[model samples]
Target chain A: MDADVRQMTWTELAALCTNLEKACTKQLKEEEARAFASLASFYASKRKAQGDASLDDLLALIEADLSTGYRSANEAANYADDRGAKRALLWGEKATKLLKSLLARYAKQKEALTADTGVFVCEICGFVYVGQQPPEVCPICKVPSFKIHEVKKEAI
Target chain B: MHAARNLRLCTKDCVCLFICPTGATNTETGQIDFDKCLDGCRLCVDACPSGAIYLVSSTYPAPQPKHPSVLETLYSLVRSKAAQEDVAHSVKEGSDDAALRQICTVVETSSRIIAEDLWRESGYIIAQSEATRALLKAMISEHGTMEGFPRTEVEELLSRLS
Candidate 1:
């Protein structure tokens, strides 16, 4: 007997929730894209890295970076398949969790900027998110990094 | 329910969509349509060219033996509402307020999601595999997360483990 014969079954539940997940994921991706773009612009004006390196350049960098991780998980999963569900799940869980942990760590890094005195700022885009307000998720370039203009106040 | 998978690294092998018995796993546009996916079918999870699709259970109990869908819920709602209205009419005519509240509560659940009944996605996790099963066990007992998956389901899983 199907273990979950009582409910809609695992297959059915997956279908219903799949769409909801897609919607949320799309929003998240768009946010990520904008963040990368904004970061790229900041670097361009500050150090003036090179000529016309837009947000796409940064995204290309990210894609290049993640290729190995993506490939590794697939390889691991294949190895697990023959081994059994236990093995498959092991490979899946570890790979997924690793990525999840990475994302969590990245979020923490972005948050570290909170303690800064606000001197060195991102040059490409002079943007700062205030404590009271949530920054706009720039869809086009995708970064909300504050653009620094060298603010000089009282005695330094 | 987050990004079902990391689409960036997806190899576009298109095997998952084909392997999925139901049309649950699909990549219609550039992005995947996770909403169409049927959870627990891991055919796609196994078939995925890249282990991009990561599935996790929510912190709720397993639902009752029979989980009702939107259409089913809607039909039930209409029936419950009518029943409530009938009961309310009776109460107004000669019945008591207690009966009216009972009827009203039933009506409310019919229309909206019955939060209490909707357990987190689980019970199946126990059935996944050894590593996943182990991970799930840790999550259930160690995390102190009450998902509402039936005690029977857990018991059955434990029986198998032993």
Candidate 2:
């Protein structure tokens, strides 16, 4: 019951959501069950959408990530030791720079930027790379190719 | 280890209240009294029907040292998630549609939680070593010049960590 969402695949998450919905229904909590049903659907759709996400949706997600990065930077400063804080700062700066570049490119060639290229993120550093494949190693974090994850579009 | 309750999962069976010999779980506040709780006591934890009660380690293991490159990458991912949270928060604040707002709120919360987890994995949450302080100082001096960088927060954090 105590599952880590980060570790779960989208299908697993959808299954968990469906199971929770069933559990809620068993408890006669109809409203909660309905909410879980919706969540289950959302995850299912998100898995299907994957690389097929629209430009606007992708941009919006990137923007959201940028905001999240800023907050993480602050938290790292506050709670993390000096090394953690330094790394967080570096990550924040790099992500901001990358996002700015992406926004600029999007503004200039909206359709071209989204054309067929897949969006990949470095699992270690959160560096977003738009290409057919992620780099051999992350330029920002120096991690190998396996650590880079593909960005799946959520069907919200 | 001491027992704690997850209020969300709690069914209010009150079995813990009766089973806890030290009365640590029988408090006006929902939280278990750590001071009164006996180490390795499992009476209340085993008695709870809803499985809401669980033990938390009173002492944490020393954090492993992460490579500087790895730490940077981990923190970067944290930043990315945090940025997403900010975007979700803005959407939540600006959208008039209730459903859209709810979705945005969820996204915001989820992203923040993920970011916190990443922070913890970076070896900065539980214990601060001297290396951590030195790293913070180096960051302030090197990266503080970047636009919109939170130099003040870093400085404040440095003082607190000290």
Candidate 3:
């Protein structure tokens, strides 16, 4: 299994896990389906951790990128020819703002927050919600609860 | 073109089993054998009750070139997402709590998905395309020296795409 996994690309492995989970669910094997889902997440984490970058370096890089994204979004929004394009760009700008604020908060309160609260990200708009449960609807994009994915420390 | 099945939408209707002339639709493996599948034969695609089956083109159009500024922003965004994935991994490693670890996994996965999307947007739409190959080569030469860059994986991807 390890040899097979090592040979497969991350995308292929993810697809295989997703299909396996679906098969298990179709067979009414709920526990096995959940196990496969967890396995998928675990493998994803393992792949993401392959490099030697320190957490601080990653945080710093993200901060710089977010700042750049914010600036570009603002520029795009200003020049957008159509109202719809401008609105969408503005939404992106707002999302970047939210992400920057979240990153700042996380940096300052990492230890305390990691102890109890889980981070939930809105899949639609990148809104970060730090709490035991995500809001009923995303405040930024108005997506329903199911769209808010919880980020935990480990797979169940 | 060959038939493909989306496992999520497949309803076990078994219509494809009978519709496929080459017996390419195998439910046991949950895959449609591309070699066996007849080109332009979309019987299964039309027959699947749940609309799970579809035809994929064997050839892809050339990727349109992205604007320089757009590519720059996308590259930065991709880097950001990649870094976030690493941060999630680090957080997951630092914690022993099962729930927290699970959340970290979600974070990592989300970052990866976003990075892939950014790559797709930057004209890397077809894995076998020359544009994708050029982009991968450029990434290897440009960012390969960066600390903690996934140089090996990028090289492997370039070889595969070649």
Q: Is candidate 2 or candidate 3 better by lDDT?
A: 3
The top-ranked prediction according to DockQ is 3
Ranked by TM-score from best down, the candidates are 3, 2, 1
Better of 1 and 3 by DockQ: 3
Model 2: per-residue Cα lDDT over B1-162, one tens digit each: 777787778989999989898989988879788779999998998999999988876444556666554555554665455445555555545545543444344344334434544555465443233544554465456545755445665565556445
Task: Report lDDT (Cα) of residue B150, candidate 2.
Answer: 51
Instruction: Give the candidate number with the greatest TM-score.
Output: 3
Across residues A1-156, which tens digit of lDDT does each residue of candidate 3 receive? 011333334443343444445544543445545654654454454454434544465457556655676468346434433333334334444554555565566557655665777777766555666779989987766878887887656443
Alpha carbon RMSD to native, model 1: 25.0
Model 3, position B13: C-alpha lDDT score = 92
Model 3 lDDT tens row, B1-162? 878888878989999998889899974679788779999989999999999988877566776655555555555565566566667777777766665455456555655555544545555444556754554465456545755555665565456445
Candidate 1 stretches with Cα past 4 Å from truth are A1-156, B1-3, B60-162
In terms of lDDT, the poorest run of 10 residues in model 3 chain B is: B117-126
Worst 10 residues of 1 chain B by lDDT: B111-120
For candidate 3, give the docking quality class from DockQ: incorrect
RMSD of each: 25.0, 16.7, 9.7
